[model samples]
Target: MSLSELFISKELTIKDSLAKLDKTAKRILLVMEDEKLQGIITDGDIRRWILNNGDLNERVELAMNRSPISVYEKDVKKAKEILNTNMIEAIPVLNENNNVVDIIFWNENFNRKLNYYKKLENPVVIMAGGKGTRLEPYTKILPKPLIPIGDTPIVERIINKFNEYGCNNYYMTVNYKKNMIKAYFDEKEKPYQVNFVEEKTPLGTAGSLYLLKGIIKETFFVSNCDILIEGNYSGMLKYHKANNNKITLISSLKHYTIPYGVIEIDKNSIVKGMMEKPEYDYLVNTGMYILEPECLHDIPANTFYHMTELIQHYIDKGEKVGVYPVRENSWLDMGQFKEMENMIERLGVSNE
Candidate 1:
């Protein structure tokens, strides 16, 4: 990772730190203030805070470790020993000024990958029934699920990600160009089991989930075919069960910057405040959810219903509907042409 990506401000929210971590794909961050090192935070620290039900909006300083391990730049050669002895993934490199000049990860030069969680047997339900109107010309020829990100289709990539956690069983809801979706998979041999749910009629998002009532008997995942989320699937499931939530939505932190100056008016037409190009952060739904089998019963068969309505149903009934936040860049959405390009770029797909 770049040296700049490893540094963050103490004022940043835990939610923003999560985004930075996701963007860098690094498990740790160095909190720097006034050209000085303050502390360090890691994915484990954030996960612990989440499990304890800490507020995500809390300042990251609250979750950071005040004391951190470091090595001087002159003794950079010793960083590897420090990493191995401490059983840590990374360490900061400090200069004579005691400022973090660089950071070192144990596997910086290695190509090997690691898995932090054990295998999960839960099934995943991919919402592939939509016509993908936003993709337009591309959707006119190929279904959204078949649209390629890299060399593989987007839907296949989604399955492969979950498959890393040993989630082999999947039920895909198919409607628009359903035969193509089936044909493509039929021609290929896969280790995992793929079951297709034929939607005879258009059932908006959650409506088709009703078809899986009997088939899905445990906690399962629901993902939109056009979106990809790079997160810890096992962690999400753990949080869901820990909170006893009926459903847990995978949310992302999104920042929107206003281009023009904004003026605030009071009831008496007095200007309360004004700011130029202010940016606001919000948690956005990433089109992913973990749901208990019982939650499927709310959807009426053959009716067009959206997932938002189903979530609201549980909320109104006082059911435990929770949210698990991922990093902003972690959620790659291909719902639009622009985002599709971004997804392709992020996934390192060939435009040709």
Candidate 2:
């Protein structure tokens, strides 16, 4: 695709820039005015802006890279050098008048995948306590986690993903149909250790985590049994440790296009502007997180508290809570029947 299609106006809101980024999947956009390059905005810039409490409705120029690296047409070779030297993905190509002419994308063949040979010793806590009300009849017979995605159960698939990353220890929080979940694993000779934390009643998502307070004395992962995250687990762990974040939430970019014209109004009831079928982009929580041991102290004991409330508590305390963004396709939600079918098809799992 041409770089011109990736140009977004500097006056556009940060929200608008995010939509542009998601639509293009280029990870960066050139901010232009009168066909002249003003600056550039990237996915990382937007993520940092959100982390620092920047308003979404603010102009994109507020968060754009004003002194971005660019190359002239004659310096095309220099583009590769800059990209390699700075370890950047793309660079803008500028004309004699400083107008953005094109964008030089790094060759995908040069991309190197990091080797995760080292095993991660951190414990992973899977919340399998919830009643699968959404997927009834089937869930009436089997617990949500025990539902088959292919030949393997959903929870086992979740465990296998972590196992691939060398996380051998698992703690499962179970309530409804807990016996079946335990029995299934008990019959098998598993490679990793599984410890069950039986909830007397249906404690909410974060409530069950409190049971592991004394047990987990380090940073660990918390995931919902019904969701699967397809991304770099090690990268997320590195980010959580590097930033010293008390909690790191894995978020997915979700795009919603409004099918009708939308109106904006002022306090005086004046029409500010009108947008036609505008698209909105959001970073939605994918029911996964990395948490420090200290975070467990905040969860009220034996109460129905959600992870969202726990996050808010930390936020209200002015604590550092980080968010790691991934592409929309990377998150697979299997809680509902439709999403489960989609995942089954994607994985080429035979329904028969």
Q: Which 10 consecutive residues of model 2 have the lowest summed lDDT?
A: 108-117
Per-model CA lDDT versus the true structure? 0.87, 0.86
Candidate 1: list runs displaced more than 4 Å: 1-23, 32-38, 43-60, 67-117
Alpha-carbon RMSD to native, per candidate: 4.6, 6.2
Model 2: lDDT equals: 0.86
Clashing pairs in 1: none
On a 0 to 1 TM-score scale, where does candidate 1 land against the true structure?
0.81
Deviation from native of the Cα of residue 305 in model 2, angstroms: 1.3
Per-candidate TM equals 0.81, 0.71
